[model samples]
Target: MRASLLLLAAVVTLWGAHWPIMKVGLAHVGPLWFNALRFLTGGLSLFLVVALLGRLRVPPRRDWPLLLSVGLGQMMLFGVLVMYALRHVPAGRSAVLAYTTTLWVTPLSVLILGETVSRRKVVGTVLGLAGIAVLFNPLTLDWSDRAVVVGNLILLVAALVWALCILHIRAYRGLSSTLELAPWQMLLAAVPVTGAALWIEGPHPGDGTLTFFLVAAYAGPLATGFCFWAVNQLTARLPAATFSNAMLAVPMSGILFSAAALGDLPSGPVLLGMAIILAGMATVVAAERR
Candidate 1:
């Protein structure tokens, strides 16, 4: 249990830091190109590790659908949406909104997957939206400022789409090791992401600075590759509710990391939103435990 806790913490920290890390990388490369490069690098890194461990293999035919969903829905769509959103949204706020996918999952599961929705989850869902509303601050917000509104809405929709992907993953039952499928999923997602990059973003600039390379390395290898592997390791040891709840910390940590790394300080409303979001997430976790 202690080991699981530590592993969970590490995963949360890695994911949290990724928001700002990605922001840094994007400063040096186009969003679409950066995503393609990072995922391609991550995929190859995972392939190397899995191959060294003698666990790498092609996924079976039936598994392709699940893999495709993960690649398309979770990887390509989610990454592209959030990356574009991050251009206009603050790193901390973007993290907060994106993490709302967890909040969306329960209600979505109940509605689409026919799973039961507890009263607590309903309350949690309400609190989560309230947090978003508060952060949105409609009373003072200029409706004409399309950038901010569009950025926030994109994040919210991305979170919902991500929830769908999570449901797809949860519904899959398979004999192939997750590690084995992981590289393929990355590669599958890479094809479209790369294509979009070529068509929309053209090629990355041939000359990248040291800072760009450093940020790319962190985003690709540590954030994407190792973070995925670490979470998979901890998942089997931790309770589902505990794991989900632990993820609530990721965005909060993202706020702090962004403040330090990117000098992104949250405004009062943002802070309040973060608190409320955490409270909502707590309620959801408690309900799941019950």
Candidate 2:
């Protein structure tokens, strides 16, 4: 249990830190191309590791529905929308908005998966959403600006897409382990993303900077590949609402990491929102421990 908690911590930290790194990468590459490269690199790395372990195999036909749902909806569509939105959104704000998946996940899990959520978890989710609302202060955004409005809306849609995928994962009873199927899922996402990048953006070899490569290494192998596996592993063990609420920590940490890496300092409301979010996550953790 201790080890699982540690792994979860590591997953959250790596995922949080990746937000700022992605901001850096977007400076040197187009959004779609960067997303395509990320999925390709992540897929290749996972494939190599699984092959070395002699665990790689073609996904059986039974898993195709899940593969397409997660690959296309969660990974491909979510990645594309977030990347495009990130171009206009601040990394910290973007992180906060993107993680609203928890809000959508709780109700969906109960309705679709027939999972019963504890009242504590429900309250925690509400608190976390309240924090998100605080951080999302409409007063701060220039409502007249189309790019800002559209970008924020896109993030919300991405969150909803991700929430649906999480429910599918919880409901899945499949022949392959999550880790075993991860490479194929990534590959499935990569193919169309790469094609879209080529068709729409028309590739240019990135600025050839060391920073770009470093971003690729972190976002691909560690964030996308390893973190995805870690998340699924935990997801299988925890209740859906509990798991989703616990993930509220991701935005809080993302904000801190963004401040550190990108110097995107948080204002008073952001700090308050982070505190509220932390309290909400703590509430969920306490409920789980009981």
Candidate 3:
């Protein structure tokens, strides 16, 4: 009810803000360790919650591969790749690009998934991209800067992998609830993340500083764990259009949280871009309402 919505909102806000907080956190922790902590802590926390709620259950063996794909794609590919990419890019810029994938997902859904593109959805996609351009276009390679090249490339790949993961999940309509799959998938996904942290991150982990612990815990438990659980719970009752449409607010919240967290200022063009994006989202919401 009210509490669940607040939890989801808090989770999304933290996740959006995590883009910047991670920039600071990653400085102290290596890439693998950062991701390892993210998945491990959140996975374990959700494991307990799901178990207590009696929602943890494994699908049949035939379905194992697909479930594992979601885990690997999300936890290993998207999570790890973003961590590596963030090493090279600014937090705010990376946040903008990470979300800009709405543009890619729309067309891909049409071609690959055979989902028809309503004009409102198309408008939403275009405006979302325009917003991204305003927010992040200048952050790209310039006349003098080449340092973030690797990071930017990795982020692009991460976004595509995420779309793939999301599309893969969309193909699954009989999961009962996404929460029912979390403990299993998180457990399955943890094996690789642990090994990667061990092999790639070297011997040390981050010092248990107050800031590090808080940010890391929030990203894993509140953001990923509780958020996904909430998604499963809410979507079971709400219309897909209603549920999906709520995502339109995420980028705006991300930017607002960015300004609050980092004291980063959005330029006039960026603000205008955000407005256009909201207008597009409104169009989609309007169409869906009918």
Candidate 4:
């Protein structure tokens, strides 16, 4: 349990820190192009590792549907939305909004899996909505500014879709060799990312700077490849509620990292929203624990 907690902590920290690094990468690469290269590098590296370990094999036909769901919904769509949102959203706010996947998961679970929604989850959902309202500050929002509104909506949708994918994974009862299969999922998601990069956003704008290469290496190999493995491993070992609650640390870490690495301090409004969201999530966690 101690080792599991430590590993989970390490994984979240790595994931959180990657947000700023991604911001840096985007300055040099287009969203789709960056993700395509990142996924390809990460996926190919994992494939090599699995092959070297002699664990690589052809997945059964039965696995294809679930694999595609995860690859497309979780990786491809989620990654693309996040990358695009980061173009306009502040890193700290983006992290907080993205991690609302916790709130999304409960409703998705109830709807898709016929699970009962406790009163606490309902309260959590309401509070989560309130936080979003605060974050948006509707009274002052300019309807003409499409970027902020679109970015926030995209992040919310990304979080919801990712929640659905998590529930999908939980429903699959026979997922053996998740580590071995993960590379294939990454590669599957890479197809659309690569295609979109080629068709919609042709040619890299980067000047081949050392910073670009550094960020790409971190985002692709350490953050994507290693973190994916860690998430799967931890998910298999931990309780769902416990895992969700523990991952709250991720957005906190992201906020701090953004402040230090990217100088993205949370404003008064953002801080308020974050506090409310955390309280709501804590309520949900406490209810689950009970």
TM-score for all models, in order of appearance = 0.86, 0.97, 0.87, 0.85
Error of 3 at 116 (Å): 2.0
lDDT of candidate 3 over 1-290, digit per residue (tens): 46645755765676777777777788678877877777777789988987899766667766675567667876677878887877777676676666655655666666776777677766666666676677666643663656587677778787777666666666556534677676566666667877878887776778778888887877788766766556445544433333344454565676777778778777687688778777776777676656
- Candidate ordering by lDDT (highest first): 2, 4, 1, 3
The parts of candidate 1 lying over 4 Å away from their true place are 1-4, 117-142, 205-207, 229-245, 280-290
Alpha-carbon lDDT, every model? 0.76, 0.87, 0.68, 0.78
Please list the residue runs of candidate 4 whose C-alpha ends up more than 4 Å from where it truly belongs after superposition: 114-143, 203-205, 268-290
Error of 1 at 53 (Å): 1.1
Model 3 spans with C-alpha error above 4 angstroms: 1-11, 138-140, 229-248
Per-residue CA lDDT of candidate 2, range 61-149, in tens? 99998889878988899999999999988998898889899878988888888888788888888888888889888789887989989
Best by TM-score: 2
RMSD, one per candidate, in order: 2.9, 1.2, 3.0, 2.9
Model 3 residue 170 CA deviation (Å) reads 1.2
Spell out the clash pairs found in candidate 4: none
Highest lDDT: give the candidate number.
Answer: 2
Q: After superposition, how far is residue 126 of candidate 1 from its true place, in Å?
A: 4.6
Name the TM-score of candidate 4.
0.85
**Model 2 error, position 225 (Å):** 1.2
Find the 10 residues in a row with the least total lDDT in model 1: 235-244
